[model samples]
Target: MQEIVGYPLDNFSLNLRDIVDLIYFEGPLLTLFENEYGDSYLYYWCDVDEQCNRWLVFRVTRKTLRFYVTQKLSLRELIVNPVDGFLYSIELDDELQCQRCCLIQPPNLPPKYIPAVDSYYDFSKLDPEETEAKGLLLEKIWDEKHELSDLLTKLFDKPPLEMIDEPSLA
Candidate 1:
């Protein structure tokens, strides 16, 4: 358990949300630490470049920790969801020296919801517009069936879109 009180701060910059954003996207392994005062912090190492790597520490509330331990919310949820108050973050160098410290204000937007059908379909090759259209279509189909197995069975019964001839557009 690393303590934050005695940690050295140098070249500290405020509002490093970009670094936090990277951590949120990468989903690195999290280590929990507590200071003598019982403040909870999550620590994770991030490699920003070939030569640069840093440790990110986020101070989280007890309620947030409880939700995480109880499996009621995921770690990513803790990062993206707006906290009751500001979320404090510390960026430390390889030697555990603080390079930046900031309070992050999470956007007041809903967490992104990934539908189950995303796992079944490969949308990586599709353009943005096509991907959105296909995703919506798949979501609708998935909702109608309410089960992946049922959706698969139904899909197998129907002719593929490519197999069906398109009407001539004169």
Candidate 2:
């Protein structure tokens, strides 16, 4: 599997160690899908605490992943925009460290929903076993390692447009 450089955990209050623990040990990937532009969106179920369990979706661009793999960016720089959710952008200083991050609120959204945390799945009341089982099943179908590598290979190595000549007119 290709090495992963960064994760989109900047919006959260987690430190590097906590982020790694959450990703590798605690969180279970729920699903993954690619957009027409070859960008990958991954959803993960995180058991943040005894009282809080939520879902997070990350939008990782091909360029961003490339930058991450090359060590040009840190995991905190990855943008975690949940599906049909809030948007956030991060700025980095010359030292390649995060400078400032802001939530890009949509104008149509109400002020009460500025952060829009409600869009994500909150499984605080659900049974963990069932949720995790479903998550594992999803992981099996859209295996992150294989899917990501395939998408990255296509994005980086394949031609942007396929040219097929039209059949000769009779």
Candidate 3:
């Protein structure tokens, strides 16, 4: 299956050490996160470069999963408007060190809705030195990943595969 553009990746070529060097989260925090949130469909990954400009986020709830990519700007607030109405943002300094990280949860939304993404480009094709590696077209990526086709089908309200399949004609 094709990969989703701007979606947090479960499987990637980069190792945890390489990935950790790029993002703010440490082993302890990551472990705590898994405990707080169930591990099924967990999304996590970052750009494999010195300046880790982005991160993929995902939270799987008892009911559903939410995903999006949060941006990291130089000396700027990490989160502007959260899609899930809640977030955990880590701001990095110019030296690629964490300045501050915070968990922003509004009273209006429940605890379940969380946030996650990867870039739109194919990592292998992009130049290591080039920063504007916003690779593939969004529409093409979306369609290729089956995101547009399977999103609605993935909603928890839909019946399970066993029920959907036709009974064999004996």
Candidate 4:
């Protein structure tokens, strides 16, 4: 196993919570399927189009990764947040607390463990445990999100305001 003395700024650290939100599974995405019920699973594409949000609809199939990004969303913002995504949402045991599952260097490292100054990374691939962990983290974050309802309003096929009514004339 490759030790982390120093790693690149863009390295993936995964732990199994299976939190990713799959899009292909929702209804046969890309040209892969036409079924309305073919839900996207762990193995799907992350489509990135200029006219779409900078989101990833990723999947791992036969040990190969396939991803597509949206053209509509700014590519830079994707590293932080995307309408759809591939990320980790760390879960605190406390019901009200929130933490992000991250791979970045720990703030306080022991004297023995030298933080790698040189850029290094393992691009070989992610193992099963890692995949499951990231997905789980994303799922947890999705559950605890504070603005889900409002975001959904914007995502709906109908306009955000059309589905609601004016305040009752009480």
Candidate 5:
């Protein structure tokens, strides 16, 4: 027998920092989100999946990312969908230096169920530049550190992965 590994991560490499960043983004998501409620005294990292889609959420506030997704909603569907309904996005505006979040429903879901969810990123504790830099550095490292894109493609055909629901995953 050969050395046993937890999972076949041969396709890519993941560092501790990467894990931390992901936790900082997705902790709230895993747990039921109350948006404006709860205390965010802690920070963490979340491990996504084979495709490596990472996300970050806060306890004190709510922030969503439109472009930053690990594996999309398809993967989540395979596991579960406990959301109240539909989906939304949490995005940030660097030029203005602020944080905001919003949740809406999918086109297939009733438009009445979704709201106009939008806001800037929360950077009250750390400088926007500092926070942004750290996340960006991690992102850059992950993006170029390894051929993750190609690896994911190899694992799941481009079509199946692309068709996956995203909001459900986050």
Candidate 6:
């Protein structure tokens, strides 16, 4: 099997507890979902756009803390999360006690593991031909997102605020 190589960073430690603390302590906690067992999950996106894009997803359970980096590998694949997701699972000795935290890294990892570097795609920087192609792709993406939002709104019986141009106030 070929090794997955990424960009190296000085502060690219994969300590689960440390990562969780860092995310919480840094600020602006964006919780994606929570379970019935009082366990909350967070999906920290790398970019402003949120369309099944790359993200750092984690869940804090009563006895365990898990996290992973999800990236879109291929457009042809139908998988939700990336197959090469760098995952980590940490088990707490006691409830909410991180003193005896045990981290479990996935097996068969490359000897030289590197951190992923963030990339910014500026549409304005592209040439005319490239811009047209990229613009079309982006338009399709936004269209699909809009359609999904509308479907969900109808499914949940919620008001279609996004679809409406000017909401009526009465």
Best by lDDT: 1
Reference-based TM-score of each model: 0.39, 0.28, 0.23, 0.21, 0.20, 0.25
Error of 2 at 45 (Å): 5.7
lDDT of 1 by residue, 1-170 (tens): 12223234455443222211112223443455555655566554533433334444566676665455434566666665535343444555566456565454544212231112222222232233443443333442233333433433343555446445689999
Model 1's alpha-carbon lDDT is 0.43
- CA lDDT scores, all candidates in order: 0.43, 0.38, 0.29, 0.28, 0.28, 0.31
| TM-score-based ranking | 1, 2, 6, 3, 4, 5
Over the stretch 36-134, how does candidate 4's per-residue lDDT look in tens digits?
332222312223223321111222221111222112222223322322333222223234132322232332222222222431212112233444533
TM-score: model 2 vs. ground truth: 0.28
Q: Candidate 2 lDDT, tens digit per residue, 1-170?
A: 11112334455332221111112233343334454544555434422323333333456555554444344554434423233344433333344354433444334223332232323322232243454433332333343565544533443453223322358999
C-alpha lDDT (0 to 100) for residue 69 of candidate 2: 36
Better TM-score candidate (1, 4): 1
Off by over 4 Å in 5: 1-20, 23-75, 78-82, 95-102, 107-170
Residue lDDT tens for model 3, 19-94: 1111224321121023322232222332233443323332333222222211222111122333465443333335
> How would you encode candidate 5's per-residue C-alpha lDDT over 1-170 as one tens digit per residue?
11111222222111112222322332232322221323221121122333332222222211122122323222233112323342322222333111322333333323222222332222222233454443442343344423445433433345234434478654
Candidate 4, 114: how far from true, in Å? 26
Q: At residue 77, give the lDDT of candidate 5.
A: 36
Candidate 6 or 1, higher TM-score: 1
Q: Where does candidate 1 clash, by residue pair?
A: none
The C-alpha stretches of model 6 lying farther than 4 A from their native spots are 1-84, 93-95, 99-148, 151-155, 165-170
- Scored by Cα lDDT, where does model 2 land? 0.38
Top TM-score model: 1
Among residues 3 or more apart in sequence or in different chains, the pairs in candidate 6 whose N, CA or C atoms overlap within 3 Å are: none
Considering TM-score, which of the candidate structures 1 and 3 is the better prediction for this target? 1
